[model samples]
Target: MSKRSESFLRSRELAVAFKASIPVMMGYSVLGFSFGLLAVSQGLTWQWPVLMSLLIYAGALQFLAVGMLRAKAGLFDLFVAAIFVNIRQAFYGLSLLRPFRKTGSLKPYLIFALTDETYALMTTRKIDPRLKRRWVLFYLAALNQSYWVGGTVAGVLFGSTVHFDTRGIDFALTALFVVLAMEQYKAKRKLLPFLLGAGASLIAMVSVPADRMLITAIVLALLGMFALRKRIEDV
Candidate 1:
C-alpha cells in the first residue's frame, strides 16, 4: 500500500475500533467515577484525577500511589513504592511490542493505556493488522481516558451527597483484576504466568500491610516471571 493509503486506512481502522469499544468505554466511566468519588472522600481535588487520567492512566497504580500521598509519604518513598506496583507494566509492554511498534506517535498512548482492562481487550486478538495498528491504539487510549475523565467529573459532583459505605467499592477493582486474569488464561501457557502472579500477590498480601502489599506483590510477580520465563514462552 502507498504511504497515504496506509495512513487513511489506519485512521479508518481506528475509528471502527473506537466504535467497537463502547462497552469498555462505559465501564471505564463508571469505574473512573467511583475512583474519583473515592479520591474526593480522601480530600483530593478534581485536578488530581484530571492529571492522573492524562498522565498515569494505570488505574491500579494511581489508586495505590494516592494512598502514599494521603499518608504524606516522602517523594522518594512514593517513588520506591510505586515502582513495585507499576513494574508489571514493563512486562505488558514487552508482550505488546509487535502491536505497538507500528503505532509511531501513538505508541506512548498505547503504553499508557496498558491497564489490565485495556490489555485484556487488545491482546485477545489471534490475528493482527486487523485495524490500522496505530488507530487501534488510539481508540484504546481515547476510550480509556474518556471513561476516567467522565468518572472523575461524576465523582466530584456526587461525592458530597452520597453517604453509603465505600468499603465494597474496593472490590470493584479486584473484580476487574479477576476478569483480566481470566481473559489472560484462555491459553494454557498463559495460565502459568497468571497463576504465578496470583500466588506471588497472595503471599505479598499476607506478609505486608495494605499500604505496602502492592509493592510486595509486584516484586514477587517479577521474580516469579523471571524464574519461569522459559516456561511462559512455551505457550
Candidate 2:
C-alpha cells in the first residue's frame, strides 16, 4: 500500500478498535476513577494514579498498591504480592503466545497492555478478519490504555472536590466479578468450570494464609482443570 493508503487503513483499524473497546472504555474509566478517588482519599498525589495507570496498568493490583503505599510496604513484600496476584496472567500469556509473536513491534506493547478486558476482546477475535490482526491488536491495546490513563487523570483532578458517600463501595468490586461470572456462564452455559474454581478457592481460603490464598486457589484450579480437561471437553 502507498503511504496515503497505509495511513487510511491504519485509521480504519483504529476506528474499529475503538468501537470494539467501547465496553472496556466504560469499564476502565469507572474502575480507574475509583482507584484515583481511593488513592487521593488516602492523601496520595495525583501523579501516583497517572504514573501507576500509565506504567503498571493493572487495575486490581493498583487498588491494593494504594494500601501498600499507605503502609509503606517493602520492596520484597510488594514483589511477592504482585507475583501471587498476577500469576494468572501467565496462563493468559501462554494462550496468546502465537498471536503476540506475530505482532512485530507491537508484540511488546500488546503483552504489556494485555489487561483482562483487552485479552478477552483480542482472544474472542470479534474484529473484522480483513483488518490486519497485528494492527487491530495494537490499536486495541493503545486505545484501552489511553482510556484508563484519561480516567485516572480525571479522578485525580476531581476526586478532592467531589466527596462520595460510598459506604459500601468495597462490595462494588465483588458485584463486578459476579456480573463477569454470570456473563461467562451465560455465554458458554457451563457451570462446572466456575464451580471447580469456587471449590479450589474455598479450599485455599481454609488451608492457606489469607495473603497466599488467591494464588494457591488459582494453582489448584489450574491443576484441577488439567486433570479434568478430557471430561470438561466432553461438555
The number of the candidate with the highest lDDT is 2
Best by TM-score: 2
Residue 61's lDDT within candidate 1 is 65
Report the number of clashing residue pairs per model: 1, 0
**Residue 116 in candidate 1, Cα distance off native in Å:** 2.7
The alpha-carbon lDDT assigned to residue 213 of candidate 2 equals 64
Candidate 1, after superposition: displacement of residue 225 in Å? 8.2
**On residues 1-235, what C-alpha lDDT tens digit does candidate 1 reach at each position?**
8999888877777666676677788787888887888777777887886688677776776676666777776687678766765777788768888878777888876776677667777776433545555676677667767777788778767875776666656566778778877776764536778788889889988887766666678778889889989888876
- Model 1, residue 207: what's the lDDT? 89
Our tally of clashes for model 1 stands at 1
